[model samples]
Target: MTALLDLVLDAHGGLRRWQDARTVHAEGSIGGHLWSLRGQEGILATTDATVDVQQQRLVFGDFTGPGLRGLFTPDRVAVERPDGEVVAERNAPRAAFAGQGPDTPWDRLHALYFAGYALWNYLTAPYLLTRPGVVVEELEPWREADEDWRRLHVTFPETLATHSTEQVFYYDTAGLLRRHDYAPDVLGGTPAAHFSEHHVRASGLVFPTHRFVVPVQEDGRAASEPVLITIDLTDISVT
Candidate 1:
């Protein structure tokens, strides 16, 4: 493993421990005006999400409204009701954006793909960097607000369902991830700065319980306006 990757994985919890924990469960509230804009308000708000860590799959739901259930994986996504009736589904969800730009019309399935892979990537963290086909390189330390942060430039394979193939991760001196920057292709190439805080340990693994994503300026600085997304996770477990 690269030195940077080694330090990050060890800080979050050893790679071996993460490998053994095949699943993670988290109860949380996810909210943002973006959801309402997409007509999926409250879809993931007040949710109980279970993630299959090894397989990169997620099943989430029990929302307040219609009690929607969702299943998401790299290949496809499906939403069902409490009665196990499939409501919406999309196969090869990534390909759905072929030749499409940021203005592509989004449906419920697209939202599923966006949320599914994004959360999976977030929850799996440094361990995800260890996967095959992920390329990581150390970058010069970033100095911000009088603190120095180690940085990594990562390139994900096309098969991986992340915001974009290229992303940058920033870690504090203690080796915990503090910020991530990416341009989400699905969102019309919107640049975002994602910050993680309020870390807590569960089952030997560390997780950031609070997360925020906001728009980034042309110069790669965070905007001063409202956040695009906010997620607060509690009651977390891994096994």
Candidate 2:
């Protein structure tokens, strides 16, 4: 299992290389018209962040023209603004973030990406056991020509909401997650939904470089709410 885990890590960018460093910085754009974030436009802002795993500290500065400053660790979550006014504060165990839920698409997307990108060590590190009741399955090789990609599927055993029955994750030859598929939590029900994204290796970390959210709509028309959201990362560096 440890060797297999190493394969997975190497497939990403090498665990040894990433774990060797205590802090990493990333600049990226998150949430916009693709996700139909009202009043947000392309490149809503650029962000600079530092994560210190040993100290369990995160501090990020946003240049999106005056907004939130955030710090998150296993024990606490704090937020402030450009004016140095703390806006929110919370102290809770990290486990609280992993409860079963009646989730919306937004919920699943956020939970998956946030957990996957920021805390992959917690999920895949050999020391920590996999979440209970969450069965992990290894899939056969599959190819998508349009995207010029091949994948290994990782299936989740649990459902998302009452209806979210299936979870499928795709990794490239390198083991970085490229897509997520969610299906109805029922027998022979609605089709699966696909969330496809791209990742860039910045600061020895693979973060979402591009993302598109696709809803399985019956009418083939745009969703009442934005069915698709895309984020493009730029100017990433660690200080």
Candidate 3:
């Protein structure tokens, strides 16, 4: 790992600790204007999240209401009941966004794909950058929120479906991930600034328990109003 990556990982409980965990669980509420515009408001407002630490997989229980869950992975998206009965399933789900635009409304599966990969990426980072086929490079410092934050530009292999193949991660002097910038491919590559704060540790792993996403201005800073997405986590644990 790079020196910058090591610093950030150590601040977030270390890669050694992360490798010891298999799964992560959390209870959270997620919402914002993005949902409203995508016609999926309240879909993930409140739910139990389970993520695979070793793979790009996540599941939101009660996602479609009680007795059901939304499953997400790079290859598939599905809705199923607790009994393992799948209500619907789509293979190679990312292709579903072929002709999507910023104003386009998303179906439940589309929302499932977006939320699933996003949370997985968020929950397993710094360490995630060390994965095979992932490239990380430290960039010049960025002045933001009154602090000069270090930046990293990461490129993910096509096999890994994330907000975008190329994205930037900003870390504070203390090595916390203060902000992240990416373009949501499903939204026609709209620039976005995602902020991470209210950090908490669970089973020796660190996470930003509260976060919000907004538009990125020409200056590479976030616009203050109109929050696109808000995520607050409670009872986070890794095992």
lDDT of every predicted structure (CA atoms) = 0.85, 0.44, 0.91
* Over 4 Å off, model 1: 63-67, 81-84, 97-106
Pairing residues by index, what is the TM-score of model 1? 0.92
TM-score of each: 0.92, 0.53, 0.98
Best by lDDT: 3
The 10 consecutive residues of candidate 3 with the worst lDDT sum are 98-107
C-alpha lDDT of residue 52 in model 1: 85
Worst 10 residues of 2 by lDDT: 120-129
Candidate 3 structure quality by residue, lDDT tens digits, 119-150: 99998986789899999999999999689999
**Lowest-sum lDDT 10-residue window in model 1:** 97-106
lDDT of 2 by residue, 140-185 (tens): 5555544433333333333212223345555565655666554433
Model 1 Cα lDDT, one tens digit per residue, 1-239: 67888888989998889989888898998887677766677767776888888877998876333578778998888888988788888888987866765444567777778788888899989789988899999999988668899999999998788898899999998889999999988777778989999998999999999999988888777885668888899889999
Q: What is the C-alpha RMSD of each candidate to the true structure, in Å?
A: 2.1, 7.8, 0.9
Best by TM-score: 3
